[model samples]
Target chain A: MSEQEFTIEALKQILLESAGADENIDLDGDILDTDFEALGYESLALLETGGRIEREYGISLDDDIFTDHRTPRALVAAVNACIKDTVTA
Target chain B: MSARTVITGIGVATPNGLGVDGFWAATRVGKNAIGRVTHFDPTPYPSQLAGEISDFVAEDLLPSRLLPQTDRMTRLALVAADCAFKDAGIQPGDIPEFDMGVVTASTAGGFEFGQNELKKLWSQGSEYVSAYQSFAWFYAVNSGQISIRNGMRGPSGVVVSDHAGGLDAIAQARRQIRKGSKLIFSGGFDATDLHLGLGRSDRRGRLSTSSDPDRAYLPFDAAADGYVPGEGGALITLEDEQTARERGAQNIYGEIAGYGSTFDPKPGTGREPGLRRAIEVALADAGVEADQVDVVFADAAGTPQLDREEADASSAVFGPSGVPVTAPKTMTGRLYSGAAPVYVVSAVLAIREGLIPPTTNVELSPEYAIDLVTGQPRPAPVRTALVLARSYGGFNSAVVVRAAD
Candidate 1:
């Protein structure tokens, strides 16, 4: 499958696997614009998620990706963009 | 008079058993948990026997989020902390967060976790390493993680004096209590896989190479060789007597009455070892005569020279076979930083139950002028107990526990 195929569902899976979803929050609900702190995903948890993504996709995620993409929607877009660039190059 | 410090709750993950009841039951019966190492392949190491918590599955006991971020030792410590809080009937918000503190001890830190990350950095390159490596390998991670998870914002610290650190951490917790903190979680735990490998490679001379579990770690025995390393430990919930009484704490285990520590004199100076002085100071601090101490939990190094030194020290303080001494660690091996705290747990339980647990599977040498309780549990009127521990680098520490009024 193309690296561009990275989706919100994939990001959801990674987030759950890396940091675990908050007990009270539902990941299936509308949470795209919600802050990570609200979802109980702190900086360290996001760093671990980034590490897993890089290892699985064979791509390098810039350290700033964690700060720049604060939610699943933004992180998914950034990962897809990096994958597209890697394929094109 | 100053407020007394008592241990209201205890949690343990030990080779022989888990939790206070499980560990105490096994210990009372002299159950042996040492065997061929199974945490990792022991074929490569000379000392094959170890006391491993063979049945512990961390995923079954802890939240999944914690598994990725923490090392095995930290997971065990967290569970122990949870058990301690539950045992004490104190929830996170039960008391003000600022009134609770954590003081823990660690010798190997996260050796298994660090070794795995270092392997990735070497063979698979640095990019393959996990981000958790930033703090997971630290010696203070146990104290830090316990405090963060429990929301304990009061005084916190980690002691790293090897075996002696267990008592040192308790002493530190007592100090925090004296400084006005209402409650403190203290003690330690160790995960011995990579640490055991390293010990075999660097200090194999001090580890038991025997394959038989029964004969592997016979401290004070005529056939004693060297100690078998073990994993797991205990975390105690300590509160001021007035606070526990005012809060109606269910089970007051005993009081952490007194503590003393000293470093051994440099070799060749002809100055005697400091173990005796530490014991004397602990007794004096407790304001009790040596005769008042009903039992002694010996350091029991399991090596002839070190065991002789400890025996001599005890004999000097309590007279020739004056006090009944036991090393329940024979069943669990030497747990490094975990040893002394577990002994403290045993001591308080002994005081409560009026029984002294045995040093299993050992024939004491007649040459040592000390009374070694062996083979079976000894029923006695145990009121005050003394626990002793010594580290490889000459650190000696002693703690006194007594029946709480």
Candidate 2:
């Protein structure tokens, strides 16, 4: 089976499922550059999302991913990089 | 004089009903909510009946985000807190954040959540467990979740004295109010069914094993067995009386006049149980004479030995049948840490309406001289009510609630 690629759409789904979207913020809009905090996702929410990603994708993620990937764009890219490393290695 | 602590709002989630109005209505009419445990299969257990809030769907009442992080108990507590805040007609932002606090009680913490996580750990490995389990399984999570949700940052805590913890937590909130906090959300809730199995094996020997709901938990009855376990409780919005009046609080339920707690001496010591002392101290603290107490809300453990002890204590303190005693918990079962606060709610409501709710399904044995109010709701001038609770490990607590002037 082919591996699923980590994308902004995937991250959006995970964010919504893990933390739920803020009523005031539109998750479908250009939220790639929006900070998770601005999107109403806090550290605990990010931790849950990261845990879900690791379990689903068979990859381990560092806790600092929450701090380093503050936006959906950065988190998607970081997750895709980890997936690629797992596939190649 | 010290500032008086009064309950301004009440939110309830009980087996018989939800919210203050629904619960009080069912309680006053002596409705029984105990039935076969449907939360899970009870066919294998000896004790099949419990007071379950079968219709409560947390997802329907709470935000989706909270659904992922909280256990059923915490969800119930959060919802109760929301109802209390709304009932009080005061928003968290209306008061200074630092002026509000949360003090709650928990006996089992979030056992169902912890049990689920443990199952995941054993079957799918520890990595499969949800990170939310970290806080969800904690006893203090109810207080923490309520605090975070309402921005109550002044002082927060969870009392864990089992059944007595409910009144203990409210008393702690009273202390915070005395210390100048304007608003405090206090009370407790429990949704743990882990002990049902123990009750089956007679390990605790404190659960009713009858299949028939009507005869299952007959406290003070000649055929009394033991208590049917239950879930749900209440969150009371307690405010400094002066502050509540100044803020134009629409309803002031009653003043939490006095509190006293004591631990039972070792069983083999032959020392008297501390329940009587607790009641006396509470009356002294409230400066109320024993004869002045209009009604007594009993712990009603439902076991013969414990029932006799409670009856003896009440008779000794109030003189034989001197005060009208009731245990509306007969309708809801013993809710562990949640029991006392609900009784407190009943007391406050009784004070307001001057109608004492009845102890349903219980036939007081003539051997006990206490005047147990049963069969029908008693109409009387209830100006002051005393609530009593005793925990499994011999913790006893008493609180005196009086009508606000």
Candidate 3:
């Protein structure tokens, strides 16, 4: 698999593992902007999501992720950037 | 007037076993809770053994909605809290959210979560990092998670006073009750996994590298080196006396009769005048003479200097006589914030069952001889137990637990 594909698959796996979302979480869909409850999760879900992604991808994130990436779309962007950086790193 | 507080419920997750029943049973038989580290590969790490509660799976406790957000320690907190609430005869929904509080402690929370995030950031690009990583492993996650889960709207606080935080959290809860809070779900939880933050500091010679469980935590013996760190602490539902009576809960385990805490002034100082003061204050608060304490629950930090300081303080208090001393922690290593509550729980059982579990690995030598209970367990009717604890670096705490009829 290309690094990009690996990154996408990895992010999906992380989302699936953490959120327990079986269906592919559409990175482009507005599902990105929903609160965890709306996305069917407790608020702590996002932290776990970020945690799982950091572990599998091997990255350190800034503190803002907790407050900055509120929407699903914002979260997707965050994940995408982490995945890209890890691939390059 | 200070309200009298009683422990109506207890929740425990530890290496000895899961839940209060298993934990109490294991210690009753003087069973060892130590084993080879499996949470992470230990092939290259200098330390080989730890009192690990790595068996817990979050799926078992969290609701489908909250599963993703609960960290391992928080997950354990939920389990223990549920168990304790049930034991106290109080359902989560039964209590008015505003009337209840949770005082939880963690030396570090979400450590595994943080470590993983950092790993991803270093090996992968910075873009790979997740912001949730920030709070996943902060020091306050335990209390935060408990409050969120139980919907407790009362006062909540976290303590980083090292391992002693467990007992101190309980002491803090009792203080809260005195100040008019109706209930408190209080305790501590910590996890030191295989990730980078997990074993690095301990492996840096902070942890005893002994492979044998029995020999690994010989607290107070002349050969003491260091303590092995472990996870899965305990919490109890502490309520004021009038409240417990109103609820008709009669099986009160014990009373949070008294607590004392003092700092050693500076880290790594052999001076422990502060430790002595803490003990004196706790005893004074309890209104009990030093000799009146049936047995002394020691804060046996396997560090040689700390052990000596504890022995000297204890000896000075009781005059080195027959006030039998035991540190059941030796069998399970040190659980940091998890240790004291587990010990306090064990002390309650000892009072109820009429047996004092022995300290596992000790063949006492001249340097430290305060009647260390070792090799075999002892039978004694304990009416009151003075539990002592000192945190890593330098926090000291003592609490008095008395038999509840």
Candidate 4:
């Protein structure tokens, strides 16, 4: 599938698979510092999103970018960087 | 009533095997459970090998009423707890609910459940996802579900110190027992058996990608780079000495003689000072000196630096005198929260059997100098055993187990 075919829903799927959440999650969702229950997250949920994005998208986010990327919108931007890198490579 | 706690029975559903008989047989012979992921299509993933508890059938373990509400981790706990209660000869209805409490550890909560729901929502939309999906993926999900299912009315809690929380939960159990309680169920189980948790660790570059199964989890080895994530559950029934004797249900795996825990301000230097301190505290708590420790169960984390920290802390406590140390977990990938109880079980068996299983795949090391067991298991008359664990996030727990006298 082309990069254009990957919608925000597709991106959400990638996020959900990689780190463990969905587009229904607050793009401004505080997945790192906040109580996941208040944010409606439980049981190894975030890991699904984190795993998929790193493996499928080829994004090597190993340097503690979690501090700045507190929200899903910020996470999306970071993910886009990985997408950019993958497209360029 | 002398508040001494003993593991009356143990039930395990781990990557190594399904039940206690299977688990013990696999572990005693030193079998490796690492393999490519089969539960999901892991073809596109970075790390191919993991210690997956793929053999477990949940409905086989959980109560019919509670099965619908429990997570995979909870299912593992319920099954193990049942085995433990039965192993101790404690029937479900026979035990007093008010006297029993559960202290457990969890790292992932319900990643799989959440992932499945998200899949339905992403593919068929939110309408396809079940409303009960809300309860399946939270950290407290397992503890609450297990307690309600088993009718455990004592203290119920879940520790969150990464994987170290597993061992730490047991430490709290010991404390509660010491402070005054009848029977305590203390153990932990974690399942990140999903792409999300796996992705996070992979993105953080924390897991081993070496395709070779046997060579994947080389704990304390020089080339040991990272751990391969895994899942499983272990539980034990701890009863007060008098209470156990009065009921005639005391096989006594061992006593939770002493327990200690500490936190390092930052992940800097070998957490030796803090770990050494915890060791000292546990030894004192158990009323035993360092030399009396016959065998040491090292949390050979399969991460180079962490392993070194553990080795140094141990050497400082035991003082260079080769106190036979073993990390049987090399056979299974580090279960994090699942590691401590599993190690404790091995320690209990080591005390019972007078043998320390070998540390699998330890070719060499970079700094720490505690005699690393390699190739095969070592037989020794272990009177006392120490299980030391340190978490990557924050938490160091030490438990001392003595030969049941």
lDDT of each: 0.90, 0.90, 0.76, 0.74
Candidates in descending DockQ order: 1, 2, 3, 4
The runs of at least 3 residues in candidate 3 whose Cα sits more than 4 Å from the true structure, single-residue gaps closed, are A1-16, A21-39, A42-89, B193-199, B266-272
Name the better of 1 and 3 by lDDT.
1
Q: What digit string (tens of lDDT, one per residue) describes model 3 on residues B1-405?
A: 466788888889988888878887887777887888877777776677888875677775666444554567777888888888888888777878888998887877777777777888899856556555656678787777778777888988887886788888998898888888888988888776455544565644657878777787778777788887777789888888888888898568888778888877765464555777888889988887888888888888887877888888888888874588898887677777877888788878888888888887677867864877777778888888989888766788999898866
Model 1 pairs whose backbones collide: none
Can you tell me the DockQ of model 1? 0.59
Candidate 2 on B243-314: residue-level lDDT in tens? 999989998999999999999999989888999999999999999999999999999998888899899999
Interface root-mean-square deviation of model 4 in angstroms is 12.7
Please compute DockQ, using alpha carbons, for every candidate against the native two-chain complex.
0.59, 0.57, 0.17, 0.02
Candidate 1's C-alpha runs over 4 A off are A1-4, B195-204
True lDDT of residue B59, candidate 2: 76
lDDT of 2: 0.90
Question: Tell me, what's the RMSD of every candidate?
Answer: 1.5, 1.6, 5.5, 13.0
**Interface C-alpha root-mean-square deviation, candidates in order:** 1.6, 1.5, 5.5, 12.7
**B139-193: candidate 4 lDDT, tens digit per residue:** 8776676676679888778887876687788878777777777778888888885
What's the CA error at residue A27 for candidate 2, in Å?
2.2
lDDT of 1 by residue, A1-89 (tens): 46456788888888888877776889999998887878888888888888888877878889899789888788888899998888887
Candidate 3 docks with a DockQ of: 0.17
